[model samples]
Target: MRRQHLAEEIEEIFRCSGGTYGSPKVFIELVRRGRRVSVNTVAKVMAELRPAGRKVRRRRSLTRPGRRPAPRISSAGTSPPRNRNSSGQAT
Candidate 1:
């Protein structure tokens, strides 16, 4: 049996959270409020109405060392000692 206008009320819940609502949580909340909604339906709504402020991280390409050492900003200041010191200790 259709509740006739449950989607509208549920939609408000999703909107109130700024579109960050997921189906399972929404389902639980609806159940708490004595409203019945299929989890699958909620998931479908989220897939259709994805919220804002969501981001995915992109994978980075691997780097290979060339004949020369890589130029890193970590050594920007404090020049190496004039002596060819392998150990940090001064001779």
Candidate 2:
């Protein structure tokens, strides 16, 4: 059985954060509100409460886009040039 009151509080905080806060954040919020709960316990509670609510947003690229497009590799199915002698004959 869950601690009904703590679970309710966790749910409230999680909902307030638009379901973006994971265990760490939820735990921090709970501590901020004077709740003496461990982070691991909060994580366990969250895991049970809303398994699908934790959505990891994609990380944005730190570097800016290049001015020029990237150089494309030739896929012409051509092999590397053969080794040639000084007279241009295949060695």
Candidate 3:
């Protein structure tokens, strides 16, 4: 549960932060708004008033290459190690 005035501050934080600020940013914003306010109070109020962030959906590509038959390979095993150059890593 949140205090009524704290709820108003949460709304003000959302307005100033443009809905992008989560607890961390909103906490800092609250500190900036007034010297007397503490970050913990802002963080708690923001958590109750608004969601942290919206779920992000990745774009799926339906335009893929047509199905094709697998190719035959003579040896599908790892190749033999080659000589390394001046660098310590393998060539």
TM-score of each: 0.44, 0.57, 0.44
Per-residue C-alpha lDDT of model 1 across residues 20-45, encoded as one tens digit per residue? 66677777778888976788876666
lDDT of 3 by residue, 1-91 (tens): 3477767876776776557666666666666667356767767766677656433479988766797768976666878668888887776
Clashing pairs in 2: none
Residue lDDT tens for model 2, 17-87: 88778888888898999989898888888778864355677999877787666899997988888999999
Local lDDT at 39 for model 3: 69
The models' CA-based lDDT, in order, is 0.66, 0.83, 0.67
Clashes of each: 0, 0, 0
Ten-residue region with minimum lDDT total, candidate 3: 47-56
Ordered by lDDT, highest first, the candidates read 2, 3, 1
Most TM-score-accurate candidate: 2
Off by over 4 Å in 2: 51-91
Q: How far is candidate 3 from the true structure (C-alpha RMSD, Å)?
A: 15.3
